[model samples]
Target: MRNLRLTLAWAAALLVAVSPLVNAQTTSEKNLKSDKKAAMSKETLPRPKVIIFDVNETLLDLAPLKSSVGKALNGREDLLPLWFSTMVHYSLVETLSDDYHSFGEIGTAALMMVAETQGIELSYDDAKTAIVTPLRSLPPHADVIEALKALKADGYKIVSLTNSSSVGVETQFKNAGLTEFFEKRYSVDSVKKFKPHPETYKMALADLGVKPEEALMVAAHAWDIAGADNVGLQTAFVARPGKTLYPNADKPDYVVNDLSELVKHLAATKTAQADTESDKTLAEQLAAQAAKSAKRFPESVRKVYAEGIETVRATQIEESAKQVGDAAIDAELTNWNGETVKLSELWSEGPVVLMWYRGGWCPYCNIQLRAMQQNLDKIENAGARLVVLTPELPEKAKETAATNNLDIVALHDNGSAVARKYGILFKLPAAIVPSYRDKLKLPEYNGNDAMELPLSATYVIDKSGTITYAFLDADYKKRAEPADVIEAVKAAAK
Candidate 1:
């Protein structure tokens, strides 16, 4: 009964719409509690791979349901706030007492308790009909659909976690036209536990194979944010009508008045991050990478690689390689799946960024490949495609693709024939031959004992089959940067 008084106090505050959760001004302002944290609040939110949303007032408009619940309380429409708070409070009580009941059943029980307290004679059956009927047919708010579509288009995995029963949310989404947006929907019935219990969130994380830190929980209820924040997931608070953060809980990563605001914040943060990445030039990136990798290799191996780089520099091999204004070579090769690929046909759509590397065994190649892949989207957005040429066997090329988690189009240039056509092919240094063939198993990877490689080269060719840009480097450590290639691609596009 004591706890019930506290619940009613919160309900009264919510009914008035005059204060933050529990009337503490804000759960956020009080939770700061220190100067450093308040300052750190200015930091932009880190991007999340997946977003888990709470369905009730966060996604749906609960205002329409008040009429039905009000009808049960003898026309006392305002008591709807008290009934909701009571239902949530009792759900917590049910969990703490080691008992289990579906959320709908608990809602009915809460409605009965509210009526009994009001001195109104309401039967259990009447309470159930009032709460359960309107709950399932609630309409979604105005700001929901567009924000959900924006999130999906940006490649975020969206799912719902609701205290409502499975059939309950399904009917609501179906009625509200929200079923098409979510990849999945979860109900507390799956774990037989209500939310704010920690286990409910954990159940979803485990099922999705997502780490807590990799997910963001978005909810209108402050208690829902509290639960997710304590468990190490990123949180976003949606300040819907009558929804506020709990005064004692940690501040959410984002606090927005609607789902549209949430999407705007995310877009701004991503643009800021991209700007930060753009500030560093690719040459500076490679030099930093070379310095870091230099420490990982032994003196003997490093000496051989250094000598090989110097030898190529002395020979001036890049001067004879493919250059801007040259007619692009048309070479037929097999992709990782053993499908034929022609450079001429590939660039017919727009432009193609063709890069050739020795094989996956070369650390330099691996580093360069990863760097380019990180900017693959940017390249494509510039109206170009990227194709990687490697002398490794198709099977080994497929293995490399999987290992690096790269989705770039990779083709196997079987005997370095394409490299020779580009005039960038070269024989492996004698000093590195033994280790390259025996220890690194280069022969098996390429299905040959030719002991050869290519001067790391990249070319941007226009749709007319003319090489618009070329990057040829004799010093293996000095590969072309993706940033430079993007610029060249932009140039070629004109």
Candidate 2:
């Protein structure tokens, strides 16, 4: 009994000694969470592949529609919003009940219901005319066109996904001059559903061939944002006049006052980390490799290599080659699997990190390819594709891919044809060409007798085919660091 009492006393003493530290840790975590929640209010969302816009009231102004509805409701313009709400409610009712009605018909019914609730006489034809006519001819919101133009120029896929019917949205867009802005316009009428229905959003994602996370639903209605959020899509809430967020719904990724402000946030280079730190750059490693390899070669051969590099530099090929801000040409090249891959097609899905390798025989090229493979995940996570081009035959490209175990795209730039277009193709040193032909078997590998090869260049091209980053060098040993390319991809996304 005495021993038990002593052990209990020890346990109590230990708890007392550690209580303060445990309390401090808990308090710190709570404060950190509090700070994070506060910061979220000012945070902007990441860029999405497709921006799905809600048409009614979100892009189009409802003031004219309101006046028309008010005239039908005995000059009670305040009842216009109520009629719209009733219309939306009935849409949900029809969807859940497995019944379908055109949005115009529902709107007409809703307006009649509102008129009856207010003890006013209304006819179906008059209500239909009031709702459909004004809704079709409604003017676009003031901030709509310029913001849409900016996004379209940036190569963002702009889609209009709305509760309005297909014919209704078509008429509306044509009348408002918005048909030119949208890549596609989808309507709930196709699925016979309402805005908050999950299937409506799913149908769009399916048709567009995009994952839910790749799309952002922008709307003025809190309920719509809630539906999109629940469906695993990022959402933006445009707090237009008289529209407020739902208190119980999850907060949207963005809460902007207008589309113009949303564009500004999307354009900010928030993810571009130019100073992203690393232990060593690929260029530095290449320098180290060059120095080490020099010991293996004779002094005469080393002198020849130096002259070749200097000679190429004198040509100023870097100035003539495609650089940043240039439009990337759609070079249709075949991959190791004999699949035709076009640069424009690749850029359509995401930003591309296009790299040129001399051949698998070069030690420096192998080193750089391995480094790029290691950083492949980082590049892809930033929403970019890594495409490695080599002036080797399709079978030789396969060998290189197998040798390095490279799982990403490896393409054959047959005959250095694509390289010539990029202005990076150059003749080899006359002294070394004979030895390279015999020793490296360059002619057999590339299926050409021309002693020409492209520079070890790298470029990052955005979805619009605009080159956002380029690395050109005469020295074959040097390469663009993968970390910098990843940063460039992130910047290109903005």
Candidate 3:
């Protein structure tokens, strides 16, 4: 009996010690399974041929609309988030109830709800006008246009699929100057459902004549990504500020902070698929050529070049200047003949190519001017005028034009005032000032004591006053190539 008791005691002790180990093993197995599931969930997918972009906050910026709403609400912009969330919620509610409401109407209703909750009086008509009008004129988010152009250049059929009404999307695209980027604009109203609904995504796929797996949906909203992923479409989630992917939804195939990163991802896939070494973008080719040319310069000259390149790299002029969608600022200046000319008058003829040059002294400027002169025929043929602006006085400007044998109109910006307005004027760096003052005599040529010069930036302005192409760099040697300028003009004319 004592042996039996000893054995039982031992068994009981063993059980106590091993119980925790068993529990730990079970927990470990569960964790392993969970991790494996997550890994599978995030498995990368193949690229898609067609890319569908989401409008409203995805591509178009809504901050201005928020401001307008805030003005209507006694300067309470904090209420915008609640209003937008409420609108999205009711949009889904309407979709689930087999009902249909235009996004604009939903926005108005949401605004009204917010006003009521805040105990503020807001008329329905005022709400509608405030919300809907801004919606129609919203500008695209930064990095949207360039990314879309990159994707399109890579042969992807880009389209916009939104919950907005057809007319609403049309006006939005038109006002945003994004109509040309999209091959087609789709509205969820056609399917009588809002996004995050499988039907809405499926409808877009059907309309594009693409299978769900063959198309990718790019959106700033997690719900949009979730809905597209649920319907078997590839998804790219653009995590705009304050946007997050839904934890419960399937992981998107790609996640980026903005459209520019998405474009880089897609462009890499395209570059991988190219069969030959010659299939490269113009920008890439130019960069390669510039690198090759840099090797030939003497060390002193190369140092200047390096400094210029570094300065340009440091200054994000391209981002700060009037970009593709911005209206070109009208400026008044005198032509080389001392006749006052306005930029608006130049645009009245056709598309205008506005260029800035340093002065008659800079070899780089002369090279660029002569190069542009060679392409003047092509520019004029494309229904565009090539107008050059220089800080040089009228006689010096005339000298530069005659020296290059250029027939293009040369304007004299006497005080660099017009250049400053375009965000292209900068004071000469201290290192370069001695050369300009002693060797170049820039003050005499430009007739300016300020020692300021405009960056040799070029812009292609369309007839609608929108700047379609802008090449602004602090490095004067990196002026826009004539061929690229011609291509830009052609695009503007189109």
lDDT value, residue 116 of candidate 1: 79
- Best by the lDDT measure: 2
Model 2 bad stretches (over 4 Å) = 1-46, 269-494
Rank candidates, TM-score, best first: 1, 2, 3
For residues 198-232, what per-residue lDDT tens digits would candidate 1 score against the true structure? 78888998776555655899999999998887566
Model 3, position 235: C-alpha lDDT score: 82
Q: Give Cα distance to truth, residue 448, candidate 1, Å.
A: 26
**For model 3, how does the per-residue alpha-carbon lDDT over 158-260 read when each residue is reduced to its tens digit?**
8999999999999999999999988989998788889877778878776665556558899999988877776667789999998998998667878999999
For candidate 2, the lDDT comes to: 0.81
lDDT for model 3, please.
Answer: 0.77
Please state every model's RMSD to the true fold in angstroms.
Answer: 12.0, 20.6, 25.2
Quick one: best TM-score, which candidate? 1
